[model samples]
Target: MINQVSILGNLATAPRQEVLPSGTVKVSFLLAYNSYYTDRSGQQQEKAEFFWVETFGRSAVNAGKFLVQGQQVAVAGQLSGGNIRLENGSYRNCTAIRAEQIEYLSKPQSRTADPDVEPAVANVEF
Candidate 1:
C-alpha cells in the first residue's frame, strides 16, 4: 500500500536544526494548510491543519538555513503516525510528514550560502 502525501502551505515556524554525534543532522518544522468549504446553510466554513515535518542528513541542514517562518513550501512524502504523552497522561497520536522532496513555493529574493563541503560522488549499478 502506498501512504504518500503531498502538501503546499506556509511554514508556521522556522526549521529547527540539530546535529547528532553519529553525524546525522535533523531539521523539523510545522506546515499550516487551510481550506474553505460552503455549508448546507450557504455559509462558508474555514479550517486549518498543522502538519509536523522532518528531514534528515544533508537535506535537514539545508532546510534549517533556507527555510524561514511564513515561507511557502511544497513537500512530497509519507504520512506517519506517532504518539506523544501529554501532561494529562493521555496519549495523543501525532500525524506528520516524513519529507521526501521539499520545494520552495515562492521566489527567494535572498539566498543563503550553504555550509562548504566536499563534492560527493556516488556509484550506481544497473
Candidate 2:
C-alpha cells in the first residue's frame, strides 16, 4: 500500500525545535485547514482541522528559522504515529505527519537587517 499525504494549510503555531540525543534537529508545528460545506438548510458551514507536523534535518532548521504562526505552507509527507508512555504511567497514542518536503507559500512581512539571515524566497522547498 502507498502511504503519502499532501496538505496546504496555515501554521497554527510557531515551529518548535529540539535537538535529539543523537544530535539530530527536530521541528514540530500545528497546521490548520478549513472545510466549507452547504448544510441541508442551504446554509454555508465551515469546519477547521488541525494536524501536528514534524520535520527533521535541513527542513527542520529552515522551518525553525523562517516559518511563523499563521504562515501558509504546503507539506508532502507520510502519516506517522506511535504510543507514548506518559509520566502518569499511562500510554497515549499520537499521530503526526513526518514531513518529507515543505513548501513555503507565503513570505514574511518584514526582513531583518542582519546580513547573516537569508532572505525569504517564495515557493521554497525544504
The lDDT per prediction is 0.74, 0.78
CA error at residue 92 for candidate 2, angstroms: 8.9
Worst 10 residues of 2 by lDDT: 117-126
Best model per lDDT: 2
Q: What is the C-alpha RMSD of each candidate to the true structure, in Å?
A: 12.3, 9.0
Q: For residues 1-126, could you state the per-residue lDDT of candidate 1 as single tens digits?
A: 999999998776567788879989988777777889999999999987777788888778779878876678999999997653445666655578989889977632333444443222111110
Candidate 1 residue pairs that clash: none
lDDT of 1 at 118: 22
- Runs of candidate 2 with Cα error greater than 4 angstroms are 82-95, 108-126
* Structural similarity to truth (TM-score) of each candidate: 0.74, 0.74
- The residue-by-residue lDDT of candidate 2 on 1-126, one tens digit each, is 899999998886678899989999999877778889999999999987666789999999999999997788999999987443445667556567999999999854444545565432222111
